[model samples]
Target: MARLKKTVAMVGMMGAGKTAVGSAVARALRVPFLDSDEEIVKAANSTIAEIFERDGEPFFRARETEVLGRLLRGTPCVLSTGGGAYLAESNRRLISEAGVAVWLRADIDLLWQRVRHKTTRPLLRTDNPRETLRKIYEARVPLYGLADIVVDSCPDLSVEEMAGRVIEALRQRPDVLEGE
Candidate 1:
């Protein structure tokens, strides 16, 4: 088994399989899996959409940052973040200092296919969700590019296969994943 030396922060769009693949990776690595969004929801005793509706995005983002920072400082694990979490420079810096970010790159079509029917996404409740998703994708790609590693997501791939691909990428960095 490969040992995870630092937290693996999975960063990408909402439908890019961050939580799914991150959990798989954590299982494979025999580590705990943590989702920042889940933490926020637990703390607030509200769903993400409710948070957005009640307190707005800014407040949710602030809580996200707090959860992320606290989680990253703990033992190494797989951490799945909200889509907008990596957009903040402060969060990015904390991830860089405490862990490695893996951007799950997926096409807009794939993202839409995965998320279209999911009402849980607070950001995609717009009048034209497809167009809204496209706009968000365009705006965030550059920031995601700053991650330490990039794993392209294939629509045809199973969650385990994508997790394998991410683990392969992490293996290249000895500082992150040590020994097989």
Candidate 2:
């Protein structure tokens, strides 16, 4: 069997619109759309928070590695990873080796507006949500910058537009030229 093309992996801080943008990109590419968070829940048969609560964040992160590794082993698809997944060196190494990673760079205020209403975030549970985000952004932005491409997650860009940007960026990367 032939090796599949390098998948498009989307990474960024929480609320960077990976899910929304990845889905659109997958649709445009007419390939599978896999969210690592959703896949982790399916593989574990529990919510993300529940996994963290039951097994601890480290254990849950291990699951993230296992599941993401399996996904990367499969055919190329658009993959939306959990916010914290890239923090692990193993995860980042796997993604860099297997596919193109796109960082959807979103401003803090935009992230705040999008995430303020959601309670599903495990890391965002804090006395100061703004501070939490700032700290996370501070830690992850540089890490995310290591990706092959970075697309701005500005509010003005529709999902389709972001998807287009991703595709355009993908076309520019010689490393992702596994398929014609």
Candidate 3:
């Protein structure tokens, strides 16, 4: 088994499979899997949509940063962050300092296919969701590009296969994973 030395923070657009693939990666690595949004929801006792509807994006982002910082400070694990988490310089710095940020690079079309039906995504609750998704994708890709590692998310790859690819990428970073 490979030993995880730093948290693996998954960053990307919505529907990039951060939660799904991160959980699979954690299972393969025998480490815990955490979702920053989930942590925020838990702490607030409300769903992400509720938080957004009640307190707005800025408030939600603040809570996200707090949850992310707390999670990154814990033992090594796979942490899945919300789509906008990496946009903040503070969050990026915190992740870079305490973990490895892995961007799951998926095309806008694929992201749409994955998230179009999901009502849980508060960001896409727009008048023209497709256009909104595209704009959001365009705006965030550059920030996500700054991640420590990039794993292309292909339509043909199953969740386990994607997790394997992430693990393979981590193997190259000896400081992040060792003891294979």
Candidate 4:
């Protein structure tokens, strides 16, 4: 079968289901799914918390950049990045130039409902996760809006459904998939 020259990317808040959706999309496209955070963990041989504690966020972020670039260099995989990964100017430009960046949008209320009890996420570290999410959401909304595509997604929807939407959107914007 044929494949898209450029891969698809899912970006949004922490609970936006990028990893889940990206995985499904990759399966649907008969491609691979790569979670940048997971790749980082595998490379560093530690959880994100350990990376943050031992190396600091800046160091972890630098590793994140390298990891993102490395992942992009491989086959066109549907990559699910950390909440702040795409926020970096270099990473954003890399995605925009190389792949189809899709933003998954969800309100803070929905985000809180979905992210509750999700301890694996390092960014939500706070006395009040809801407030932290809200603030982060507000700040990142504009940057997320810069994506090539946007989807209204919440935890209520299955990852497959969201991935279907992403595939459809990218299909519509064939220009983004030029090389493949």
TM-score of each: 0.99, 0.93, 0.99, 0.93
Tens-place lDDT per residue, model 1, 60-110, is: 999999999999999999999999999999999999999999999999999
Which segments of candidate 2 are over 4 A away from where they belong?
1-4, 174-180
Pairs clashing within candidate 3: none
Residue 88, candidate 4: Cα error in Å is: 0.6
Error of 1 at 63 (Å): 0.5
Clashing pairs in 4: 5-180
User: How do the residues 1-180 of candidate 4 rate in per-residue lDDT, one tens digit apiece?
Assistant: 446778677888888888888888888878888999999999999999899988899999999999988887888878999999888999998887777788988888888888888997677888988788888999999999998888888565677777778777777776644323
Ranking by lDDT: 1, 3, 2, 4
- Kindly give the stretch of ten consecutive residues in candidate 2 with the minimal lDDT sum: 171-180
C-alpha local distance difference test of each model = 0.97, 0.87, 0.97, 0.84
Best candidate, lDDT: 1
Better of 3 and 4 by TM-score: 3
Please report, as a residue range, the 10-residue window in candidate 4 with the lowest summed lDDT.
Answer: 171-180
Name the better of 2 and 3 by lDDT. Answer: 3
Candidate 3 on 96-154: residue-level lDDT in tens? 99999999999999999999999999989999999999999999999999999999998
Pick by lDDT: 3 or 4, better one: 3
